[model samples]
Target chain A: MPPKMNIEPEPGDQTPEVGAATDVAPLGRDHGKPAHELTAEEDADGTDWGRVAGESEFKGLLASKRRFIVPATIFFVAYYFALPVLVGYAPGLMDTRVLGVNLAYLFALSQFFMAWAVAALYVRAAGGWDETARRIIERLHSSRKEK
Target chain B: MSTPLLMFLIFVGITLVITYWAARRSTGSSAYFAAGRSIKGWQNGVAVAGDYMSAASFLGIAGIIAFQGYDGFMYSVGWLVAYLTVLLVVAEPLRNAGKYTMADVLAYRLSPRPVRAMASLSTLTVSTFYMIAQMVGAGALVSLLLKDSGVTYQAAVVGVGILMIVYVVFGGMLATTWVQIVKAILLMAGTILLSVLVLAHFGFSFGNFFDAIKHVTYHAAAGKVVTQDFLQPGLRYKPPYGALDLISLGMALLFGTAGLPHILVRFYTVPDAKTARTSVVWAMAIIGVFYILTTFLGFGAATIVGRDVISKNGGTNMSAPLLAQAMGGDIFFGFISAIAFATILAVVAGLTISASTSFAHDFWTNVIHRGTERAPGEEVKVARVTAFVVGGVAILIAIVLGPTANVAFLVALAFAVAASANLPVIVLSLFWRRFNTRGAVAGLGTGLLASIVLILLSPSIMTVDPPTVTGAARHLIQSPPLFPLENPGLLSIPLGFLGAFLGTLTGREPSAEARYTELVVRANTGLGAEKATTH
Candidate 1:
């Protein structure tokens, strides 16, 4: 088993023993619990969400994410639109032969590769984001431990 | 229907049997809605692919490419890239933040009651529209496949409707997942076989296949003679407006996949956020390969078998199956027809479960009951009943509309609704910390109304042909569309985002700020996410 990461139950919350037990036991929607109550009541067991959301680590997570997703979205939209745009406005260039086929057909085929490549790249970068999130989560636990 | 009617029955029988087994294990709401969240990564992957690959994306695109050549492929390319949006923006956050429906995520920081009601409205509209499109396709395709077996279009539609309802109401998500897996396998197998046969015709050389598609002469739908230069674009849509139409279509598709409720719900079936992320990639790989081969199937049908045969038989949707008959003769035709039936069955079931889950979980439990069901099994029971009602309504719509009622355009409207109405709220709720319940409601309402109004005013609904010439009054107005575009995504999507922004700036809810932090924490890190329970 992996070594225990530094996390602790909040003051007046469930004991660490109780927390471990509930992890395996199945729980329903907590029907009696009002929707807002669950999050607000997390004061007894959960981290300081306001701090986490505002922290430099969380901001960095969002920034790095935007760096990847925003550019990725723009590039994909442009690349995909290029096919219809070129084919519609410049059929001559689109139809120009490359490797014994229409450039439009070849370009359209390349989109499959492009999509897969971009998806793979994002997945790779997301690992770092995951790491940053882990750091934030660990900080939440360690600070609670200190308290 | 045809010799394949028995094969179709056999496939249904298997699903029904699976339904019987799943029903026992799916008594609770979570199991009914999300297969108890017990589905593994790869299984959910295939299921997601199965849920997504719908008959239109498979056989329909082939027909389009067969008839419209390279232009049909423009539609296919957008579809693959669309999943990138899903991978980058929607998948994991949705899976982590949601419980059983997309509303769970969208309504997280918003006022739960009103936001959920609006979200449910958007979900139901999208589901019904998409379901109707598939039902129409199923109706047309089934009758064609079973033509020799005395099946009428009405019988085929009712049969499909009843079977899908049974699978959803009885079996719920488990039965739906298994059916999708089975259908995904069958679809890929049949496609691979057909692709191989098509390749064999050209001595197994990809070069020969490309070389030959260029010279083969065939009749277009309008009876004009056309050759492989049909491989060139502009055959379907001409310049200016045509190019604009293409751009709008790409927008709807690229954004639409990320918003589709049925597709979004599939992510919730997995174990965690990471698995949800992996499943998108899995689906992308399977769907991408299938799409590339489908284009090949269209070329084969257009070149080797000729468009005259395809259009004369049953329009473009029949291109792939006809190519199967042309290449492998009668038995292969039967086999392919059965696979097509399974494909339609799986997709409609997926749509049904998502719709019903939203009705019972969001509308009934959350909205009507104020976020609490009276009993453990009550929500699941209500969901089953909702599935029956939803299925019945879909059957009536598909039958009343009939087989020739522009299924593709209806599908486009479905995507347009999803992109404009649903996606904006979902995206803003995640990233924009200031987005409140007012913003959610405004965005959804504005997007929903704008998309519907645009479609009603658009050319798809408003035909240019005179009633006297076309032999039918397509619209009360005889002139061309006031809204020039067929798809409203180009204009409506912007309006959706604008409505959200305006609502945020105009409205105030200090409560939104406090919960926003908690939601972001859950949405990003997957801490405190709802966990799956054992059956």
Candidate 2:
């Protein structure tokens, strides 16, 4: 039988409606194969996955990831698509000289820097997600000891 | 031997040594498929970049930009920015949830068999298409670069194919990853040196470089001398359907990159989600710089080597190597040729491993054997055989197609399939609670069929070739194009999403919906994520 999980909800973390169950067995053996290569017949990894997903911390993690990713995706896509659209449709504006090379060239050059900036920003944001994820894992470990 | 052939031999020697060492270590499925998930962030990042910046990006784009001007640079922008999708959407979750292939993530939430079958099929299809393009490009380019050494196109194709097969069949992912890292370093060194040399030729003045590009004098048709403005857009993509075509191409590169099976499989080699994320950042930095440097490589070739000379010597693909010769003479040319060859070899190895991994891990084990290897190390053995077969087939096709085929469309088709078939299902399975086995199967089938059919009808395949166009360069179908656009991404991607959404409404899989929470928890928090094996 699986161990009963008794995870303490952190401050602002929601209490899960369903209690953690002990139905699935722990996947103790590595068998040399990676996790995904293990038999599909196993229902779970002996963890109360539903209750863990219900925690506010996991919700916050998803929300935080979404908050950064959605906007960044939109911005980069817009910024990237603008290059081809403007170059193809508005040749005159793209041809206007700026500092020496044309606007089309400058606009295209800025994209490299733009990608770097977004990537750097996402890396910084991901650090916060990493911390949140760490706390959640700590709770899961603490809960597992309750059995 | 010529300098180019000698340099190529030296590269082959170094990579073979890597293969020998890796073969000893690759004893099991984990090592063969994911390199035991032991690769560090920066190393994996470099390897990812190496896997990505194929012969198309290095030779094809440079050639295009050298001749076509501002329009050709559009491809560079799309490719680098496309990494944003991989970073923001796919990489971390993939690393956390998947084992060896992209199908791992889907198999987590949906029914395993059908999804794995479809995903494996798509992976093989994409890999095969992309590999053939590189193989053909490698054959033609190697033959041209080493013509002085008496290497024919057939010899080059066969040599590249055999080397790639050896890498995957023996060394596995460890050798392939190391080879990519080595190639990435060499490629960067070569590109930077060439860029600096080009700048120095113009006395290191941006103004001088731009001034030269402003009025590039080239001999047009019938020996007519024309001074064209390389800074201006519309030289290559022009009129009628040009705008739509460029947009379609952009959509393909943008959405298609994250879905590429080879690139997706690289994340599995890293230890964790954070490492996957960091590696992508590293790749972005390297890839971004590399694409930006194409500016100098392309324009410098135009202003210095002259389009007339490049065309006469070999073709547009020779622009970079010929520019190297014009600037730093034959030694530099040979060095650049070696870098290009390394680029091709590394990418082909990457493709071979990913395709074979999908087949062995997804189809042979999960779909066929119900997720258990019948014997110890059977998966690895199967992957090795698949690699041999895949490499052999690529060689045969590249040879049959010969040197002058317009294979640029094949790469585009690969990207379109990835975007339409792979990306939609991946995104839906990850985020949507309602997505189930039926949805996934439908999405893959619809996306695969739509992209392939649209491409068949599109300008790329259906166009009428003029009388001057003959042999391999001639259009496959000699008729007017039924579909206006060259790339099928714009239409096929939406069709894939629609198929997935509608297919979900047709059936109720309560089991799949129940597993959604597990998938999300595992994906976002990395709980139960595969650990790196300690040797």
Chain A TM-score relative to the true structure, per candidate: 0.65, 0.70
lDDT (Cα, 0-100) at B486 in candidate 2 = 89
Per-prediction TM-score of chain B? 0.97, 0.99
lDDT of each: 0.85, 0.92
lDDT of 2 at B322: 93
Estimate the TM-score of every prediction: 0.91, 0.94
The digit string of per-residue lDDT tens for model 2 on B56-122 reads 9998889999999888899999999999999999999998888999999999989999999999999
By DockQ thresholds, what CAPRI class is model 1? acceptable
Model 1 Cα lDDT, one tens digit per residue, B232-265: 8887887658888888888899888899999999
Per residue, candidate 1 scores C-alpha lDDT tens digits across A81-117 of 8877788788888888889788989999999999999
Model 2 earns a TM-score of 0.94
User: Could you tell me which 10 consecutive residues in candidate 1 chain B have the lowest summed lDDT?
Assistant: B467-476
lDDT of 2: 0.92
In angstroms, give how far residue B479 of model 1 lies from its true place: 2.9
iRMSD of all candidate structures: 2.7, 2.9
